[model samples]
Target: MNWRNFLAPYAQVVEELKVKLKGMRSQFEYESSHSPIEFVTARVKPVSSIKEKMKRKNIHMDNIEELQDIAGVRVVCQFVDDIYDIVDRLKSRNDFEVIEERDYINHKKESGYRSYHLIISYPVETIHGERKIIAEIQIRTLAMNFWATNEHSLNYKYEGRMPEKVRTRLKRAAEAAFKLDEEMAKVKDEIQEAQRIFKTNKESDD
Candidate 1:
C-alpha cells in the first residue's frame, strides 16, 4: 500500500479544517469580540502511528474510516466557556457534518483527560472526486492542553505501562490544571478586555 497516496485526502482535510477554524477566529476579531478559538492546530496521523493504532484496535487498513482521528484538529481556548462556544459554532457549520460529540470536560476520562471531541464527516474534493472522510476536532482550554500534552508525552514514554505512582501523580496534576482553568474563568472578562485593547493598539500600529 502506498502510504502517501492513502494519506493525501486526510492531509487535505486537516489543512482545510485549519483554514476554516482560523477564519472563525478572524471573523470574531474583525467584529472586535472575543473569539472562542485562541489558536488552531491540525495534522494527519503518521503512517507508523496509524499502523500501531490499527494493530492495537485490531483494525484493518481497508476499514481505516473507523479511525475517527486520522485527521485531527485541535482548537485551544483561553476559558472553558470558550470551548462550548466553539463547539456550538462547529455544529452550526454547513461545510462538514458533525457525526458525534464526546464531552470529556464534563465527564472526563479515567486517565484524567478532558477535551470536547467532535467526530466530523468532512467532504474533500480530490482529483478523483469528492471523498467524505471521518475526522476529529478537539476543543480544550490552554490549561487542559498543557496537561494533556505532558500526559501524552508521558504515555509515549511509558508505552502504556505507566507505574501506579506515576499515574496517581498525573491525576493530581490534572486536577491542578482544572483548578487553574477555574481560577482563570473568574477573571476571564478582565483578560478579554485587556486582550481586546492590545489587539486594537496592534492594529492601529500596523
Candidate 2:
C-alpha cells in the first residue's frame, strides 16, 4: 500500500487540530485570562510504529482506519481542572465528533498512566472528496505530562517489560506528581493573579 498516500489525511488532521487548539490558546491570551490550554502539539504516527501497533493489535492493513491514534493531538494544561475544562471544550467543538472518551485521570491505568483521552472523528477534504478519520486527543496537566513522558521513555527502554522495582518507583513518582498538582490547585488563584500581573508588566515594558 502507498503509506504516504494513506497517511496524508491523518497528517492534515493533526495540523488542522493543532492550529485550531493553538488558536484557542491565543484567544485566551487576548482576553488576558488563564488559558486551559498551556500548549498544543500534534503528530501523525510514523509508519514503523503504525505497523508495530497493528501487528500487536492483530489489525489488518485493510482495517488501518480502526486505529484511533494514527493522528494524535496533546493539550498540556496547568492544572487538573484545566484538563477537564479543555475536554469540555473539545467535546463541544462542531469541527469534529467525539466518538469515545477515557477518563484516565479518574481511572488511571495499572501502570499509573493518567490522561483524558478523546477519540474524535474528523473530516478532511481531499482531492476526491471529504474523508473521515479517527484521531486521539490527550489532555493532561503539566505534572501529568512530565510524569507520563518519563514513564513512556522508560517503557520504551524496557520494551514494556519493566522491572518490578522500576514499576513501583514509577507509581510512586506518579503519585508525587499528582500531589504536586493538588498543591498547585490550592493556590491556583494566586498563581494566576501573579501571572496576569507579570504579563501586564511585561507588555507595558515593551
On TM-score, the candidate that comes out on top is: 2
- lDDT agreement of model 1 with the native: 0.93
How do all models score by TM-score?
Answer: 0.96, 0.98
* Candidate 1 segments exceeding 4 Å error: 204-206
lDDT of 1 at 29: 80
Worst 10 residues of 2 by lDDT: 32-41
lDDT of model number 2: 0.93
lDDT of 1 by residue, 27-92 (tens): 988885688888999999988889999999999878877888999999999899999889998999
TM-score of 2: 0.98
Off by over 4 Å in 2: none
lDDT for 70 in candidate 2 is: 95
lDDT of 1 at 88: 91
lDDT of 2 by residue, 1-206 (tens): 99999899999999999999999999999985688888888999999989989998999988988899999999999999999988898899899899999999999998888999999999999997999989999999999999999998998899889999999999999999989999999999999999999988999999
